[model samples]
Structure formats: structure tokens, C-alpha cells
Target: MAPNFGRSISFPLTPARSFSKSSRHVRSVSLPGTTSSHPLLANLHAHIAAVRSWIQDTASLQAGLANIHALHAALADLLLLPASVAALRCTTSNTGDRLLDAFLLLADAHQGFQECLLELRQAAAESRTALRRGDAGRLASASSSQRRAEKDLARLAASVSAVSTKCARLNLVAVSGEEAEMAYALVEAAAASAAASAAVFSAAASMSSAVSSCKKTATFIPAFARKSTAPESAEATVERLHALEQCFDECDGACDMVFRSVVQTRVSLLNIMTPTI
Candidate 1:
């Protein structure tokens, strides 16, 4: 039942140990756009690579569900027979099986969401790699898990959009669609940035070119649905890849704004719909 995505390593821009160094003398580190070296950004890039690797191996939601179902049938005896009534044995088994199945769905949802999150995280990393290499078209060509992750965000946006619409129809106060779209655009823009370039907002020159999936998710999820700050390596500045990273930042910012606005609108609507819950 797992997604039939076998060639995980086919994505064009895997992390490179050798960065494109413009200033080959002084050793400095910082986030993608910031002025100074951030200790956090350095670790962040490494973690992103690890997370992406983990995602490549994780099973799909359907595979998990199928496993859950198989477990229910295989464990019927353990589920059923109390030392009491003979006729009640089969009935108890059925009831227990149903209850267990219900609980397993929760497990499935939790695990599935985690898997989806991994996919999304990898997508962010992949996007960063593409942008750093000045490969926007390559970023667009992402597929399998990456495609699913992009679709997931867009779907999240669509759901929130629907919720916002319902809110407007029901008369609620929330962020506007225009604002949401802007946030989404920022996130999408930030996604494909070059690691070698300093942040457009940064005044400093030696910041690292590494960006985090969390930063990406946090920025966008709240605002289209709501932002990077990438890292540098030892004695190397990822500056040669500026053009793409700059564009990446803008897109990332856009996505963030859109996510936040939509979510805000939905939350407002939910409050109106269920005041006590």
C-alpha cells in the first residue's frame, strides 16, 4: 500500500559538502539572509539533510492502514475470549476487534501525519537545493514524495480557503484572502533560494546559506496557510548562488503570509461555529 516511489535519490540537488566560495580567506558562518553567523543555522542544515533521508524510507499512509487491518484479524483470540460465556466469545471478539480498529485509526492518523510531515520537510530541503543551484525549473519538476508535499500544502490552503469562505458566509472576523495569498507567495518564493547569497534583509555578508524546514513551515502555515532564514559550512560562504536564494526567500515569504491568513480566517469561523467546544 505504500506509495510506489522507489528512486528517492533522483532529486537533482542533493546537499554538497563543497560550497561555492566567493571569499576564500576568512572563515565565517550565518543564516541565509542574516548578518552574522548563527550557531543554530549551522546545525539546522545538517538536520534537514538527516530528516530528508528519514522521509525517503518511511512507509505511506495506506501501507500503515493495511498493516493495522491485518493486525486486527490476526489477534482475534487475544481480543475475544474472557473465561465466561461460550456464545459471547465470538461476539466479544467482534466487538473488541471493532474497538481496536477504531483506536488503530488514531494511530494511523498520527503516524501518517508524521510521515507526511517528513515528506514536506524533504520537499523544503529539495527546494532549497534547487534554488541554491539556480534550478527553478528543476524545483518545479519534483515528483513522488516532493510533489505530494507541495500538493499537501496547496490542499491545506484549499481547505482553509473553504473554511474561510464558510466563515464569510456566516459573518466572521478573520484575515482576508488577499493577505493569505501574499503570505503563501512569500513561502513559495523563499523555498527556491540560493544558499550562497546573503538574505535580502540582512546587512551582514557572512551568514550561512542553510534553511530549515521548520522555519519554512512556521512561516507559511500560520499566515497562506503563513518564512528562512539557510547555513554555511566550514571556511566557505555559499555566496555564488545568490540570485536563486533571493528569489527563494521571496517565495517562501509569500507562502507563509497566505497560510497564516487562511488559517486565521478558519479559526475565526470555527470560533463562531462552535463557541463552547
Candidate 2:
């Protein structure tokens, strides 16, 4: 007897849970000596809030993609199989299986990316707290942790890019005619979303690098002042400050890119899951 391929996979389409809007609100932190809030610490808090928002959005996108996978599996089983064992023998190929495997790998990468984002957010929060408390040691530790998390993000981006390429070249020979065309279109949409996701990660990595550079420069400033026999030139001091400002600008630009790409990916996924009239 041929394997039963007629049964549909029963995956429930539940709406993703909404994250609390309050989580996006950054709490103001006051330094010990200053009555007013620290501006730099406040900015860090805001960055943390933005990271939290991205994490929630990515989670929703993951759920949507899972639903699409379930539907695609059902459609493949229905369209690729015929009554006779002879037909089964003729249709048996590994291309569909590989495509499905690629999808699963992509899903796993997304999960890993989410975890990295969570770690980054926590690290940022800790650094802000350390700043508020005037704990240089703790702040340095937090910065190191953030850098490590950013490294993981870079690796995940590379993985995503590889799997995305695999998905783009996926063979749909098992699904011929109109069915094949539709399947190809769906796969293309997925590929486009994956590309967008890779862009998001790349931009994020760039932002992290810029932040790390700025921190290093800032840390060296006090040491340079203490050790210097002669005072540093005014031009050099201005140049250093300019570099730090540029880093901040780069970080902000990258964050914006991530937000836009993520939104694009979500829209592509929505199209994949929704049926057209």
C-alpha cells in the first residue's frame, strides 16, 4: 500500500498574543549628584524600548510564517500525489522535502535571532542602570555583554542569508501546472521576506559596531587626559567628539532600517497566509 498523503495537517491558526504597550515606556533614571535625569542614560533607555518593540514584532511574524508553512504542507500533499502507486513512484522526489527543510531551518534562525534581541535589550537596560548608579564596573561588564550578543546577531544573519538563498532556488517540480506556479509564487514571497530579514540583521550589526566604537572612544578619553604630559589639542578633542556623534547617527539610521525591513517582512507574510478573492 502506498503511504497516505491525503490527510491534511491540522495546525490551529491562533492570533499571536499582544505585548503590553507599557513595556515600550522607558523609565527615567536619575544620577546621584544630579537632580535632573541623565540625558545619555535616557537615550539608552529609549533604545532599549525600541529593541523590545522589535522583539515583539518578530515574534508575531514568526507565528504568521508558521501558519503559512502549515498551509503549504497541506497543499503540497494534495497536489503532488495521485491514486496509483505508479503515480507515486513517478512523483517521488527530494526537492519538495529539501524546500520544507529549508523553511524549518529559517524558522529556527528566527527563534535564535529573537533570543539574541532579548539579550541585547537586557544588556542595554543593565548598562543604563549601572550609569544611573555611577557603577563603572557594572557598566563596562554590560557593554561587553552587549558586544557578545551583537556577535551572535551577526552569525545569525549569515545563517539566515544562506537558508534564504536555498529557499529562492527551491525546485517545485513535484507541483506542476497551475499548482506549481502558485507554489513558486509563495516561495518567492518567502524568499523576499527572508532577504528583508537579512537586511534588518545586517543593519543591526552595523549599529552595534558603531555603539561599541563610541563606547571605547569615550572610555579612553579620561585615561588620555590623566596620562598626557601636555593637554590634547583643541582640534583633536573636537574631532573625537565629532566621531562619537557620527557613531550615534549611524546607530539611529540602522535602527530605522531594521524597523522598515521588519514591517516589509510582516506584510509579505500576511499576504502569504491570506487567501485572495
Candidate 3:
């Protein structure tokens, strides 16, 4: 099915700004699936699958967008926090208070993300119920709630990305060889995170449009079914879904790379923080 709805979505790629002279290259990594025997990888695969299933179950377009927004928020935190913490540690200005402030902000952001996820889940459940009962009014109410959640998620993503860019721009010198490596890795992670979030936002927008189209087409289904009429909207929805799925794949790859970089950053942080006798 071709997406001939005369509407096109464009994703503009911006070159990642280099923050250091080392020039770290970030490559997209493949996500591990359930077929993998490794416990960690298997668990990750299960977690992603569960989230995808939840999105699919919600029938509301806005609900799906809300889920994607939440997912992006989580990734943004993952992408930014380690580097922020590491950079803060390397700084010589107002050490103790700055460290405390950084951690507090991180905690607050994390808590906010969790709360948003809870709200989105509840909204999705309400949407599912309304859809099943064919209650148009309830569905509309749920859609409004989901839209608010989506906006909140978008705001959160933007805030995190801005903080990440700031952290990357900081010129703190690494105290040790291991710390330098970690700093470079953090830069790469930050770049990958920015690209991944963009892909997600684009995909979410496209999917939301497709879901709305699907809803509109549902109203005409009975008429089309009786008369054997070809539905152009249905075909357009299929095309959008295909594109959305591709975007998901790109996001997953970016996430995998970010996760690996995070691990590197953590190991370096641990080494720097450990007391040496």
C-alpha cells in the first residue's frame, strides 16, 4: 500500500557538533532479541517487546504517541546523566554543592519520567476501555489526556537534550587516563542520543497520523464492506505503519549504542571514584 495521502513527513539530519578534539565516532548498535541466550540481552528484549505490546493494545493514536514520548524521555536521561555526572565530578568550582545539585536534578527528572509513564499507562487503559465499548465521548476524553501527556513528554525530551548539549560543551579536563576514555565515550553517547530522539519524534508523529487515519476509516468500514468499495485511507494507513516500524528499528539501534557507551562511562566513573590505598 502506497502512502498516497498527499502528506509527507520530512526528517532533517543535523550534523553532530564536536565537543572535544578526540573526535569520537558513534555507530548504531543492534538490539539483542529473545533468541539470545544472554540474560541481560534477553531481559532488554522482553522489556522493549512489552512496551510495544502496550502501545499496540491502546487503540488510541495519542496513547501510542504518549508511550513513544515516555520511551524517549527515558533514553534521554540514560544518554545524558552519566556524562553530566562525570563532567561535574571533573570540575573544580564549588565541588560539593554542585555535585549535590546535579544529583538532585537527575533524581527529580527521573521521578518525573516515572510519573509520566504511569499517567500514560492509565490513559491508555482508559482508551482501550472506551474503544471496546464504542463510547465516542470517553474516547475523546482519553485522547485529550493522551495529548497532554505527549506534550509533557516532548517538553521533557527537549529539556534533557538541552542539558546534555550543555554538559557536552563543558571543558573539564579528565584527571586520569580512564577518565579521558570515559569522557570521549560520553560525548559519543550524547551525539547518538540526540539523533535517536529526533528519529523517535518523527516516527511518533507519523504513527499518530496513521492511527487517526485508521480511526476515520473505521467509520466507513461497514459501508465499504457492504459495497466492496476500495478504501484509500486504509491503504495510506498501511504505508504509514510500515514507515513507523522502520523508525522504531532506527531508534532501537541508537539505543543499543547508547547503552554500550553508558556502560563504558560507568566503568570509568567507578574507577575515578574508587579510593586508592
Candidate 4:
């Protein structure tokens, strides 16, 4: 059935629980099977499925980024619709606040991931230049920086996964009718998207670490032997760097889209929750 966009609807409120570290292990409320019957929600689920598929086969960075972008766009579309906005406003549980917190967490995670990519790009460029100049000291420093960036990305990915799991929980299934179903569906979809994003971050981190390992191997070769032989490891490092650079370039725009969409969705939630005279 179509959502009643024109009709006014409101839901009773439950007292919101405090968000804290202790709540991270709390299991989420189970959603009813009927929530999938909503057309917009079904569309969101399709996007979530696409993201999960890409997560499983993150062999193609381009495809992964595309799926992530689609998921975020779908979410933004769902939340911005008239009926959804109304549902958010009148949620009988604390779903609205939880969703707001989730979006904020996702926004931070995405930004951190973007910054890690930028730092990795810089390190890769420096490594290339250091190799061309045969500057052992500079190359070593660049390799260290690359490794550090990779670690940062790995940690951020873990952090995102934890936030998605903890922050997206919707408790108390007392909400009835279509509005309640929608509120639950939205949180579930967002949590799935967050998990997909974490996978992408982990992939990038692994790529960076691989390139760093190659560079370390290249650095240990004797200069005389290096002059007489083709530097296979060095060449491989360069290739990996090139591939990483390409991936980062492609991801830049996609990351921006997800960031903006999340931020806008948060703003919409805040607007609805704001007290208006």
C-alpha cells in the first residue's frame, strides 16, 4: 500500500534511553516481516542488498564505491520524502534520536576514511619520488608514513563497524502501523550501509599495506645488484601505487556524495524535531 503522504499522523513517545558505551552490546529490536511491503522501503532494501554484494566481492574498487554511493542516495531519498519525514517526526520510540546519532557517526567515519586516502596518496607519491632519486632515508620515511596511514584506516574501519552495530539499534517494538514499520526499516538499512562501508575501508587499508611491504623489500636490495638487475619489487610497488591512486581518485566524488547525503538527512531529522511555534 502507498504511504498516506497527505494525511496527518502522529505516534506516542517512549522515554529515550541514554546512549553510552554500555549500550553497545544491546541487541536491536527485531523488525516485523510486514515492513518490507512498503514500496519505498523495498527499494531501500534492494540498495542495501547491492551494497552487501559489493562487500563480498570487493575485488573491484569502482564497483564497491558505486554500490556505496547508491545506498547512501537511496537512504537520502527515503528520508526526504514527505511521508518519511512525517514518520520520523512522530516515531513512538526513540528511533529518531538513534537515527540522528547514527548519521552523525557515519559522517565522521566517512570523513576520516577520506582523509586516510589523501594521506596514503601523499605517501605513495613521496615513495615514488624517493625511489627515483635513490634516497634511502626519504624512502624509509615515506614507507613508514604509508604504514601508519594504513593502520589508521584499519582502525577507522573497525570503529565504523562498531558504531553501526551499536548506534543503529531500535529498541521497544510497541510502535504499530506503517509509520513504526518505516522507522525501523530506515535504521536497519542504514546499519547495513555502514557495514558495507567498513568493508571498503578495510580493502583500501590492505592495499596500502601491500604497497608498503613491496617498498620495504625494494629498499633492502644492494645498490650494485640493483644497478645490474631490474628492480622487480620497485616496479611492483609503482604499479600498486598507480592502482591505489586511481581508486582514490574515483572514490573522491563518491565519498563526497555519501557525506553530503548523510549530513542532509541529519539536518532533515533535526528540522522535524525542532520546536516550531
* TM-scores for all predictions: 0.24, 0.48, 0.42, 0.81
Model 4, TM vs. native:
0.81
Per-residue C-alpha lDDT of model 4 across residues 1-277, encoded as one tens digit per residue = 1122112212113311222223222234336556455567778878877776666666876677678677777777677665566667765667777777777777777777777778788888888888767787888887777776666666556656664666445663655666666666677666766676677777787778777777777778776788655367677777777777777877888877777776776787777767477
Which pairs of residues clash in candidate 2, taking residues 3 or more apart in a chain or in different chains?
Answer: none
- Per-residue lDDT value at 21 in model 4: 28
> Which should have the higher TM-score, number 1 or number 4?
4
Model 3: lDDT to the true structure: 0.40
Off by over 4 Å in 3: 1-110, 173-179, 190-213, 216-277
- Residues 138-233, candidate 3: write the lDDT tens digits: 766765765554444444444333433444444434333434433433343333433333233323433444454564463346653733533454
lDDT of candidate 3 at residue 185, scale 0 to 100: 36
How well does model 2 score by local distance difference test? 0.44
The residue-level lDDT of candidate 1 at 93 comes to 26
Q: Comparing candidate 1 with candidate 3, which one achieves the higher TM-score?
A: 3
Best by lDDT: 4
Task: Please give the lDDT score at residue 55 for candidate 2.
Answer: 34
CA deviation > 4 Å runs, candidate 1: 1-95, 143-147, 150-277
Quantify all predictions' global Cα lDDT against the true fold. 0.28, 0.44, 0.40, 0.67
Q: How many backbone clashes does candidate 1 have?
A: 66
Clashing pairs in 4: none
- Full-model lDDT, candidate 4: 0.67
